[model samples]
Target: MTSTGAPPDWTTVDIAVPRRSDRLPGISMAGFRQRVPSPVDITMVAHPAVTLLIDLGEGDGIVYDTPGRHERGSVVIGLMPGELRAGGRVGDCLQIRLEPDVAAAALGASPELSGTIASFSDVWGRDAARVEDRLRAAASWDERFTIAADILGRRLDARSPVDPEVAHVWRQTLTSRGRARVDSLAGEVGWSRKRLWSRFGSQLGTSPKRAARLVRFDHAAHLLAAGHAAARVAAESGYVDQSHLHREVKAFTGLTPSAVAVAPWLAIDDIAWPASSPTRNPGTDSPRHRARELGAGGCHERQTAVRDHC
Candidate 1:
């Protein structure tokens, strides 16, 4: 979601992170303190990360939507969701992204929740209220982060992990920005291609080839948001050319390259995540988020990046 010309009642700040220390093998956490009483509607595109948005707001105004489901307050956003719309008077929200491997344990049902969005209450059950209360009572952002980390860590520890080979396949796909070949990954994992594909899909809810393409598209999208020419971004991101890039962008986000170039969510990546975030912007290009059309809705303010593989 994005802000307009008006002075918003709420503003958000990023926690000072020590390098990638906040980066976990199967998970990453970002701290955001948003105090808001806004009326802006946000158009959230599909992100590679399975996101958990913890709303520590004062009221029940924060609304999250996707197809048939419409939830207020806290929600868990599964991977590759269609455009999600969120807006309300949310106060403090903690957004966490987990790799499917670790996510199997952390959120309890993320793997099954793939391609969909659900409220925290739906996924975490009774503990959802208790966790939100704990976060609200936290004294500082650091404390909040610690509490979140502990909660997720405990859950992850409690659940069984995906095979090491499965984890390896995901990591390779992400590190290569989704350009890694599924056949290569299967070979490296020493499993038959069919076996690897079956396991990856069962555990991650996406086929290996689709995951690779999704990550690649995500990389191209960020590059476009950074203001690189579509041609250059396409080439660097391993797309055939600008036309191919266009097709892929539309396939996933349902928006043209120019439209995605100014998405408000991609605009705030540098600010929300600085040192630990991986984006290349040297200030020559700037995203024009004021342009009011992203698929069927508009971006309101901040959104998390999908660096799930990293």
Candidate 2:
């Protein structure tokens, strides 16, 4: 399913999603096409999953920057990549989000890579270019998703997966919206606190506490973007108070709740990532039906569109 354009002023991008059968557990994919050729720049909000941004456009398709670092084209962004921005003339780009456990199995990288960005080539070697070439040659979004899913499935199956116990803990953390306690989780998984902590950190590249905070912050950010009041969001999201929410939001994106509320990045979630809500299951409507309900079947005044460049 896909949505074309929101409010012209809000966004100028078109979004496409895969069929339900194309989705993999703990993985979400979105395709973005820019409607205009003007250069684009966007602040990439931190997300709870490891993200793969595959550039399908020619010539400096996408450029990402963090303090003291710059990378062009396809890149893998880790959880909490502090203060990052993506810019450049993008034509077609595919974004893939992977749960950390799935990422660990697919990427086979160490924990140290989780809080930073890595070039696609650095992770996949020569296969990165080959895969991009195939994706670029595909005729439709569905084809690209199929190829991408096949690749991920192969890699995931080839590797020795993270411990089942660790995977369970991560799922618990997510299902609880980051409210699950580490000690309790460890007990449920039949591991001691220290073992669970060490194993989880080593396998997932983040501690249980940090994962919870990121998951919690992500939920709150979405609520804020969805137009909820900060005070109410703080209360609903399990914060100590409004002040705690402020501090955490600041720590995550270096922005206040108010600023984050209207952020273009978060604004696209309803269309680009409709299945990501922590409190809800994926919608039951057909993709086309859902798109219509979202008023995304066509443009209307004040509607938000994904820009032609991302």
Candidate 3:
């Protein structure tokens, strides 16, 4: 869901989802607001397979390339729109799409092309200045979004679909209460573990279990960010205990639950929830509740950021 706060005077923003042929029939266009700052915030947006970002024209920006999964964050500057090589970060006011290649590159693999620009530098080198010039010259946010989407569409192609069974199992696992049993999911999907993994890996670019963990971690991050107690978050997120939740949090984000709970730039509320909020009975301290707790901090931070940025 998009934030509904007061709109920015100089910038107008909207999100649209193109038809997707991948794991799901649709994709989410997460919206963000850009704030003027003394020392700019370098945001990291992660998505499954590939993530996409576009510049909304609040200011001059840069994109950095970095090794997938590397510990140290890298920085790039003065990047124009187009395909970027693996291993970089973007500057303020730039819209970013974590494309499949970028996702692959981040996961330490060579990216497979889908007719999009093969390299970030190559794309940026040619059109950055022109795009920026056009954006600056344009009078409205609608125009900027239109132009940016056109450029992105030109560079990117639709993602291929995963096996239906595999997709089903994945969604089930994500929406499940706690650590999903692989065998159980396999049974429900009518596939063996090996078969499921093979199909899932080929299509989703990550293991089903890993994907579930990521989804769960995302949930936990949201709850923590939303100001929920760690113990409550652990229970709600399906952790065996708070320690288990903490361990997973550290693994995914390199921060303790408390630290993530207060992360300045993390927007827990912005992360998409399942189509329906997963069922969680009040008496049962399910993993879902734990995940919701993490969101508390993230939601608060997002609200504050939106106000400051707007």
Q: Which candidate is the best by lDDT?
A: 2
Runs off by more than 4 Å, candidate 1: 1-23, 274-278, 284-310
Model 2: runs farther than 4 Å from truth?
1-11, 278-310
lDDT of 3 by residue, 1-310 (tens): 1111122222222222222221122233333333432333233323232444444334343333333321212122111112223222222233333423233332222123221222333334466557666755655444444555565454334433345686577667655733688888888988999998877666545666766776676667666656688999899888889999989876655557887665434332333333322332343222212223222211211212222131
Q: Give the per-residue lDDT of model 1 (tens digit) for 76-132.
A: 887777767776665677777777767766666756778888888989888899999
Q: For model 2, give the 10-residue run with minimal summed lDDT.
A: 1-10
lDDT of each: 0.68, 0.77, 0.44
The TM-score, computed over Cα atoms with residue i paired to residue i, of candidate 2 is 0.88
Better of 1 and 3 by lDDT: 1
lDDT of 3: 0.44
Query: Sorted by lDDT, highest first, which candidate order results?
Result: 2, 1, 3
